[model samples]
Target: MFRLILEEEGYEVHLSKIAFEEVHEVEKLDPDLIILDIKIGRHNEGLLLLQQLRMYRPTMKIPVLICTAAISVIREQEEILQHKGIPVLYKPFDVDELLHIVQQNLLPSETKDC
Candidate 1:
């Protein structure tokens, strides 16, 4: 669903079912932004992956947007995520909200002429 939504908006989306083991591949892709889900196969695999990605210089500066249904886990790491400038969208979020965040992350240099 998320991929379809983004694609419809003219953005290319990639799905990685085994993202935990493909961090290097992800760096190679050099995506403009990453929308990560905290519960990737395991309860907190996404968080662990996020930590690993941050440690590497290649992926440290890429924008990461976290989308998850795990409120408890989010609360625990909210401070850390905030410090790293990462944003989180809780599950069941409105599609408009998701698009808005994605645009904000991707089009930081574009300005609307008024």
Candidate 2:
């Protein structure tokens, strides 16, 4: 659903499967942004992956947009508050709002991509 809406907005997008494997695969994709689902396995959740990924020097700098059906998503975002550049996106969102946030984060400032 999110992917379809986002694609219609003229932005290229990639949606990953909900699993520990997908997080590791992110490095290969080298996407500009990521939309993460906080929960993964019934036994092992993605919070641990988030921590592991954050510790990885290469991916630590990546901006993450989190969306969850549960309000507890707040706590997860709070845990990563100290992380320099992670952005949180709540569920039940407006498509425009999501795009705006994405553009705001990915858009260039005075600093060029160079």
Candidate 3:
């Protein structure tokens, strides 16, 4: 349902709980946007992958959407992502709000102008 909404909004969304070669492809392709869940498995694995993305050559500066159910670490997460130029999205948020932010951040300046 949520995927359909994002797709309808013209986003080619890819959902994943794993950071593998496919995700590497997303970086290579450089999609207009991305959203990552915080707890892929355990121990805040999202943060680990995020850190790896920062080191990865292609995705280093991509605007990532970090979705987490944890409201406690929002502040800390903000600081980490800010340094790498990645944005975040907290869980239990409206889908529309999520899409709006993703579109706003992911779109190139020229695309936004259009």
Candidate 4:
């Protein structure tokens, strides 16, 4: 659903089934921005991947939008909260808001008119 809507907005989208897959995709695709869920699968989650990305030199600086329903859970994590640059989007999100955040992260600062 997100991929379709994003594609309709003229952005290329890649869907990954798990957090590890997303890390691999990021390594291969070097995407402009990443929309990550707080809880990806039963075992692996976004916080772990986010930590790995932050440690990796190549992917460290990439913008991440943390979109998830587990807002309360995330707030309890002091480590995740420490990263001020990462933006959080609670679940049941509006498409327009998602688009806006995507554009804001992916576009050049001067080029952003939205």
- Candidate 2: misplaced stretches above 4 Å? 22-24, 76-83, 109-114
Give the clash total for candidate 4: 0
Writing each residue's lDDT as its tens digit, candidate 3 over 30-106 gives: 65555777677756777777777778878776667777786677676678667767667777888878767776775
What digit string (tens of lDDT, one per residue) describes model 1 on residues 12-37? 78787755585787787777888899
Q: Which 10-residue span in candidate 4 carries the lowest summed lDDT?
A: 105-114
lDDT of 4 by residue, 1-114 (tens): 777778787776777768874455577767778788878888437888988887788888777788888867777864655456677777898988988878778756422111
Clash count list over all predictions? 0, 0, 0, 0
Please tell me which model should have the higher lDDT, number 1 or number 3. 1
The C-alpha stretches of model 3 lying farther than 4 A from their native spots are 21-25, 108-114
The alpha-carbon deviation from the true structure for residue 61 of candidate 4, after best TM-score superposition, in angstroms, is: 0.8
TM-score of each: 0.89, 0.75, 0.76, 0.82
Query: In candidate 2, which residue pairs get closer than 3 Å at backbone N, Cα or C atoms, i.e. clash?
Result: none
- Which candidate comes out best when scored by TM-score? 1
Worst-scoring 10-residue span by lDDT in model 1: 105-114
